[model samples]
Target: MSEPGTPRTQRLRHEAETAAARFPALLAEAQIIAASVVHGTHGRRRPGSGETFWEYRHYRREDAASAIDWRRSARGDQLFVRETEWEAANAVHLWRDGGAGMALASPGRPLKRDRAAVCLMALASLLSRGGERIAALGETGRARAGRTGLERTLHALAEGPGSTRAIEAPELPRHARVVLASDFLDPPETTAARLSALTAAGAEGALLRIVDPAEEDFPFTGRTRFRDPGLGANLLFGRAETARDAYRGLWREHGAALGDVARKAGFTLITHRTDRPAASAVLSLYQAIAGLR
Candidate 1:
């Protein structure tokens, strides 16, 4: 193991401090987005049901000693209170593409990855407010509910997007919900197969397609040079505008395929441009998720 003040240790410490500093601000934004989606209702879509979903919150002094979740509390310095969901909420698995492509953005625009994170975080907070359980797709163990679930999702997001190319198709419970945000620039067949597997498992969800303005409007002209962000390859176009039609044609084909897949799987398709308001995407995504049976 490295010593306490070693460079590696210091880097890790700095990373932790950065995440710590970001948590509050991130959560606040998420909550604000969540609230904006369904003002004064905590994003609740329906009446409460009797089902129980184990979730966590900070322990309060007024709570009984027996209410403390000793095992979870042991994981950190703070006490925790385990709670049961009193709403008609269910599980919602979440995933976001974390590839270098997602890091792409036009000038003065937020990265696709960043926009995806905001949408995911806002959706998680909205669901948590209504008592829905959430877990990273393909993660081990049960889905977490309430505030802790949102916390866990935030941490997962801060860890960076996992594999950018191939998405996992882990088994989900029947009627379970999923919410995935990505550029979905992969081969249409790959996305189709993943969705097929999940649909076959009796799961339903929404696909929030995050896009960049530059991508949507291939506005390059004379003597333009294009670089592949992932492969680091470069292509020089004498007149990039001449190729715009072909590029857009391919883009349309890809989008059409995705729409077909979502339609076949009975999932909702949501498209958001990074240049647009994140609130609109957040609201649409939450509504789509909430409507999932």
Candidate 2:
């Protein structure tokens, strides 16, 4: 077994491969969910259904019997089937926040933001494999397909120092689908407004808010140092019991506010904790995106 804190170059490659392998199963489920939703630009054709016909060629042995057009058959030496424009794949934008807050480590297992990155990358791989064009963006800027784009995206995310820069909403292409993976510790109002703008511009958006189990439950006890990962500021904390209620209350309030804003903006919000398996969170996000279609 690999030891913790091993050189990321050696260890991360194996991890990325393992996580990428899980994408196929998750995508299978996503396709099933998408089948019942409204058809969007990202949707694939039913193989024989649609109107704006695609080009036809000589019929292949595996061509569906129902796809043969008798009229076209009469005029041609060979018969072929038509595909609809709607069946063509659409582009997907996988935008992840690399801000400092996202780098905070959970008490155990994968760090909160790192886990979210993995989930997003896996989901992106699935989308790309399904024929959709995928563009991945971090806080600094965006990266399109590379020799191994999915792996590169995952590596970049894991190695990122986290964003010190303010969050800005990116202008996406019309009819494009976006998946944002972030801690969302920034001002809820600003974040909400950015998301609303994206929606207004004809882009569909979803948020995966990553949180640490410790932050959610406030399990800290005795005098402890609390540090701001983004700002690099630290403060000494007293016994957890004394401020437990207040901390929990504030956490809940923040979560509620974030949820409300996301709902009002017409974006799906999925909350993920560091302690949980990323697979479940990825599945939930896929389901939500599928629902939007």
Computed on alpha carbons, the lDDT of every model, listed in order, comes to: 0.76, 0.63
Q: What TM-score does candidate 2 reach?
A: 0.65
Which tens-of-lDDT digit does each residue in 1-293 have in candidate 1?
Answer: 99999999999999889767765665666667777776733445445554475467677554579978899999989998766654213778788787888889899987787778777888887777776777766542246776677777776764554553223545454467888888988897888888887777667889999999889789999999888888999999999999999999999988999999889889899999999888899888877776665
In the predicted model 2, the residue pairs found to clash are 38-293, 98-163, 99-163, 100-163
Local accuracy of candidate 2 as per-residue lDDT tens digits, 116-202: 667776666555444444555433232233335555555444444344232244544345567777888877887777777667756
Sum up the clashes in candidate 1. 0
- Once fitted onto the true fold, the runs of candidate 1 whose alpha carbons sit more than 4 angstroms away are 1-26, 40-89, 164-167
Cand. 1 TM to true fold: 0.76
- Off-target runs (Cα >4 Å) in candidate 2 are 1-89, 138-169
TM-score of each: 0.76, 0.65
